[model samples]
Target: MTPPGPCPRPLSRALIVAEARRIADEEGLGSLTVRRVARRLGTGQASLYRHITDRGQLLSLLAGDVALRLPLCADRGDPRERLRDHWLAAHDHLARHLWAARVIADGEHAVGTAAAFADGALGALAEAGLDPDDAARAHRVLWNLLLGHLLNAHPVGRTGTPRRHGDGSRSDFSWALSRVLDGVLAGQPAGGRWRLGR
Candidate 1:
C-alpha cells in the first residue's frame, strides 16, 4: 500500500480564519465562536487561541478581509460622481456580505481594510474643496447611510442577505446618494465650507 501521506500540518491562523469565516457565512456572525470553529476543525477549543487572540479579533479580521474586496474610487473623475460611485459600490459590496456590515457595526474593523477607499474619498472631497472637518463629517454620514440601508433591507425569511425591492436596491441607493451629495455639496464657496439649516 502506498505510504500514508505526511501527517497533516498543524492548525494555522489562515486555516482558523477560513473556518471561522465559513461559520460566519453559513450560520451567522454570532455563531463564530472559538469552540464552534474548533469543533468544526476537529481541534480543541484552546488550540484556536494559538491562532487568534479572541473572537473580537476574529470578527475584525473577517471585516477587514471583506472590506479589501470593495471597490476603490477612481483616481480622476468628477468629485461628486466619484463619491457617489464609491458609496454605491460599497453599498453593493455590503449587501453581498450582509454579515460584514454587522461586524463593522459591532466594531470599527472595516477601517483598516478600507484605508485605500477612505483615502480616495477624502482626496476626492478635498479636490471638491471640502475642508478636512467637513469631509470627515460627510464620510461618517455616508457610512451610516450605507450601513443602515443594507441592514434595513428586509430579509427573505431573515436569511443572511438583503432582499431587493421593486426596481432594485441599487437604484434606490443611487437615488438617495444623489440627494445626500447635493445637500452635502450645496452652499459651498471657493474654500468649500458648507452649512445646513438645522
Candidate 2:
C-alpha cells in the first residue's frame, strides 16, 4: 500500500493565519514559516500551500491581520487631536507585536487594513488644510516616524528597553508625535511642505 497522505481534516486560511500569528508573537516573524506553521498545525508544509502560496503571501496576510487592529478615526473631532489618536493607536498596537514594525516597513506588502487607515488619515490631513499631495507626504512622514520609533524601541527576538540611546518612554513618544504634528500645523498653507529649521 502507498504511504498515507496528510490527514484529510479540513483547514481554513484563518486557522493557518492564526497559527502563523501565534508563532510570530512567540518567536518573532523571522521564526514564522510554512514548515513551522505546518508543524504547529500537525500537518505537512505541502498542505499549507492550499491556503497560502508561500511565506511571502503568508506574511502579507499576517500584515493585513495586524492592520485590522488599527483604530479608525472618528467622524468629528479637532483634526489635530483625531490624527494624534489615530497614530497613537497604531503605535500602541504595532508595539505589542515584536515583529510587526519590520513587517509593516515592507511597503510592497501593504494590504486592505493599512490602505484603509492611510486613506482615512490622508483624508483627515487634507481636511486639516494640507493639499492632496502634501497630505499624502505628511501621512508618509508620520507613519515612518511611528514605525522607526517602534522598530527601535522593540527589536526582533528581544525584550525590555530598546538597545539604543535616548529616552524611549511613552512620554518621549508623545513629545515626538506632538512635534511632528506641530510641524504639520505650522506648514498649514495648502500645497506647502513642512520642514524643520534649516
Candidate 3:
C-alpha cells in the first residue's frame, strides 16, 4: 500500500515544542501528556516519541526554552536594580507559564534556563563585591522569595481578584517584590550595614 510514502513532511521539533508550551500555558502541566501532545499536534504518539523520549525530557526542554528568554545582564550596575529587573522578568515569565512553575516547584522538572540565570545573577552579585558563596546564596534566596511571593499573591483559579493594575489600582505584586528586594539589598554587606543595626 505504498508504505506511507516517506510521510510527506517531517514534523518540526520547534513546532512541537511551541505547541507543547502553548498547551501547558493554556491547560497547565498536569494536562500535558504524550497522548495530549500528539493530539494537539495532530500526529501519532509514536511520532512524538521519536523526538521526545518521555514527559521528563519534554518538561526539561520546555523549562530550558523558557529560561533562555530570561534577561540576564552583566553590566556591574546597581545590584538592587539588576536584581529587581531580573526578578521582575522572571515573575513575568513564570506568570506566562504557570504550569511550568508548578511542575518545576513540584520537582518534576529541571530548568536549564534557571541554572543559567542563577549563574549570571551570582556572577553579577560577585562583581558587585559580594562574596562568591554569598552571591550564590543571595541569588537562591531572592529567587525563592520571589517565587513564593508570586505564587502566594496570585493563586491559581481565583478569578474574583484583579490580575493587573491601572492608574488608581494597588500594585500588590510590585509592592511585594519591592519589599523583598529591599530586604535583600539591606542584608547585603556592601550597602546593607543598616541591616546589622536592626
Give the top-scoring candidate (lDDT): 2
Model 2 lDDT per residue over 1-198, tens place: 444455456777999998899999889877898998888777889889988999999999998999987778765767787788888877777767758778878676876776778887887797677878878889989988888777664456446756552245445667888899889777474333334461
Give the top-scoring candidate (TM-score).
2
Ordered by lDDT, highest first, the candidates read 2, 1, 3
**Per-residue lDDT tens digits of candidate 1, residues 1-198?**
343342256788878877777788778787778888877777777888887999888888778778787889887767787788889888887777778887788775645778887888887787666889988888888888887776665655444445553226677678888898889888654333244551
Candidate lDDT scores, in order, read 0.76, 0.78, 0.67
The list of candidate 1 runs beyond 4 A from truth reads 1-10, 108-110, 153-168, 187-198
TM-score of 3: 0.74
Please identify model 3 stretches exceeding 4 Å from their true place.
1-9, 74-76, 153-170, 187-198
lDDT of 3 by residue, 143-171 (tens): 77655644554346446755542221224
Measured by TM-score, how close is model 2 to the native structure?
0.78
- Prediction 1 global C-alpha lDDT: 0.76
